[model samples]
Target chain A: MIILIDDNPIDTFIQTKALELGGYRGRIEAFRSAEKALDYFQGISTSAIEADSFILLDIRIPSMNGFEFLDALQRLDKEVVSTFPVYFLSSSLDLEDRQRANTYPNVVGFLEKPLTRHVVAGLPGIRKAAS
Target chain B: MQISIFARKSDFQEVTHIKGLLKEWSPKVFQYGETARVGKLTREIVILYKPQLTEELIRIAAEVRILSPSCYLLVIGEGIPGMTLFHAQVNCALQLSEIGRIPELIHELKARAERITSDGGSMAMQELQEKNKELEKINFELDRFVYSASHDLRSPLTSVLGLLYLLREEVKAEGAQRYVSLMEESILKLDNIIRDIVAYSRNNRAGLQIEEIQLPELISDVEPGLRYLETGEITVSGCVKVKAAFPFSSDRNRLVTILNNLISNSIKYRHPARLPEIELNLERNGQHIVLVVSDNGIGIKEYHLEKIFDMFYRTSDHSTGSGLGLYIVRETIKKLGGTVRVESAVNQGTKFTITLPLAYA
Candidate 1:
């Protein structure tokens, strides 16, 4: 399962295409806001989490940013956070942001915009599913 | 100190005596010609009077007092039998024969000078503080403008890029594909302009954070975006010389921005005849770190070299640059207390040499 959190619908659609092009057969869930995504995560039963879930998150959003969402995620069950690997997707090329994003334990990678199939297949956790 | 002496031509001897007496004070003395002009006086003044000019002297003194209340005034003459009102205007009065009282007049002048100096100093200080506060308010407003502008411009651009991407797959006809590609190109150009605007604002507003940076890593990070061509010979040499022992402290984001803009410009303006070749050399020169980004591409002419760093300046007729790239580069470098110099000729290459203070104080 792949969860895509982005305020822009266009970005989400493009990411979906990129993931499909990268040969990911798993189900993908996308939310426009981090709050809605957190709500979805909370609503999901522990028994329903069968496969490894990966999240592609955007740093700048309307309600909550990727870091704020991670802080909120820390309050939830550790099993959910540890099971899911989160990757930040942002248009910003700020160095401080890249360094700051990596501090989150669940954050696995930080990729630049126009996420291509190569980038999707290159992610360590997503590579298995992509292949 | 400056002093103005006023008197009728008949009282020339008395003026000479006064000038002689006050010669030790090194005062720049001026002879007053008109009573109406006394208001324009900027220095302490003395009036040598006679009984006949008593009313004229009093009128001029009043005018002087009105224009410059702090200016010191002294009056000396034979005692006017009918004039009891003369004492009200001037600081001190002495009979012409009483030349010994000149010391008293000098003392009063000294005290007035001291008061004016202290008062004027405080007034100037207050004005400066007020101007500084006004400037700070303007800066704050500008920062707010940049923030709102970035949000307004960037959100739509993100959506446009997304829509273009989706439209690409849906439209399969050759002509339609060509149109979509052209639209995509235009939108990307708009996106680049928006990005540059945001970067320019951020560079101006954000406080500098000094940290140790690996030159090679920083260059490599921004290199990916600068590679406009699919295949090009872009070599980053002199990385070995910039080892861990060499301490370089600067704002990482600003440094990246400067390098990114320069590298991108090199690729963007490459000559179609030759493959784009960019070389970035970094080295430590004493207390400064010098980075040179040179490219063998369409070079800037001598006339355009000076104006290239100006905001919204483009050198080439077929250039696709946002024109803010070099301007932002120069601005960011200036903010970091660094200097950038460019050297180029037509059809030859352009080289930019930047020297930055290792640790910005």
Candidate 2:
């Protein structure tokens, strides 16, 4: 399962299309807000999830930003949090943002948008699932 | 100002008449030869002098003048020795009939002191007002720039990049691949232009924050961004040399922007036949820090060099840049209270020599 978190509905659609083109046949959950994504995470039972999941979080979101979402996510159950690896997928060209994202332990890597086929093929969770 | 009436006991009636006129002025009506109050008199002492013992009174007035340089001794009686009056720093010698002029003189002196104090305060206030107006103008321009950058610049770029990604995925024909690459190049050029616009706006909006600048670190920080193009095209990868020995102080951000633009330009316009080589040299020359950026790149024509720093002025027909890079460099250097000069030979090299004040204004 792939969880795409972005405020822009267009970017979410593009990311979904890119992921499908990259040969990933799986459930994809998209959210326009970080709060809704957090709600989805809280609803899920860790043991009930069978597949590997990952998140592509956007940095500049309305209300709660990417860093704020990371802080909120840490308050959740550690077992549930550890179930999926999070990666920052932002359009920001700021070097400071990359440095800041690296400081988060749960963050797998930082990728610049728009997520292309090449970027999708290198995902840790997707590659692990395929193998 | 303290007013003291020093009159002899024989002139009791004259002293009473003087006191009645100066009651509102709060004159400290002291009798002649009152040595006790003389020591305390300081800062604009006004003495109403009717000297009977002329020598003794002159000596006392001189002592007061020594203590309070601004003391004014106004003599009212006659036989005032001219040399003694000069030694005592007597401001005015008035006859008994001219006693009414006392109030007017005191009023004039007070007005003058007030004017001096207010002059300094008002000058500072005027400067503050001018600064406030300047800040307001900058803030307004910043707001307009941000609005346009979002609506007119980045929004369109975002849509195009996203659409291009989707288009690249859907279409994979042999002949159409070239068109797709061409479109990508144009989009990348637009993106760079937008980036430059943002930098330009930032330069105008922000004030100079002076700090110690390490040229080597600043150069390295600017290097990574220019090396790899956003469209997956690797441009000129040049060898850079730095020779900065002395500690330099300037606006760090502005310096970074200046160096970034210059170095990137060097890399962009590099000669295809030879390896790209760039050098940065910094040294103290008198009261100025001289910075030279020399590059072994495709140099500009003599006439083109003069017009290169103008806004939106592209020199070459093949140039794909925003034409804002050199303009920004010149403006930033100017803001640092510096001058920039260029020397170039076509297909050989280009060099920019910048002279900046050691202590930035």
- Which segments of candidate 1 are over 4 A away from where they belong? A43-52, A79-83, A91-102, A112-122, A125-127, B1-145, B220-247, B273-275, B345-348
**What fraction of the correct interface contacts does each predicted structure contain?**
0.15, 0.21
Model 1 C-alpha lDDT per residue in residues B36-105, reported as the tens digit of each score: 6554544344543332334555654432232122223443222222112233334343444565466565
**Model 1: interface root-mean-square deviation in Å:** 4.0
lDDT of 2 by residue, A1-131 (tens): 88899988888888898788767778899999999998887888777565677899998788998889888888886676753688887656454566688788888777666676655766766777656
Alpha-carbon shift of residue A32 in model 1 (angstroms)? 2.8
lDDT leader:
2
Give RMSD to native, each candidate.
12.1, 15.6
Scored on chain A only, each candidate's TM-score is 0.91, 0.92
- How would you class the docking of model 1? incorrect
**Model 1: per-residue lDDT, tens digit, A1-131?**
88999988878988998787667878999999999999988888777774667899988787798889988888887586654788888775455577798688878777666666555665665677655
TM-score for each model = 0.65, 0.56
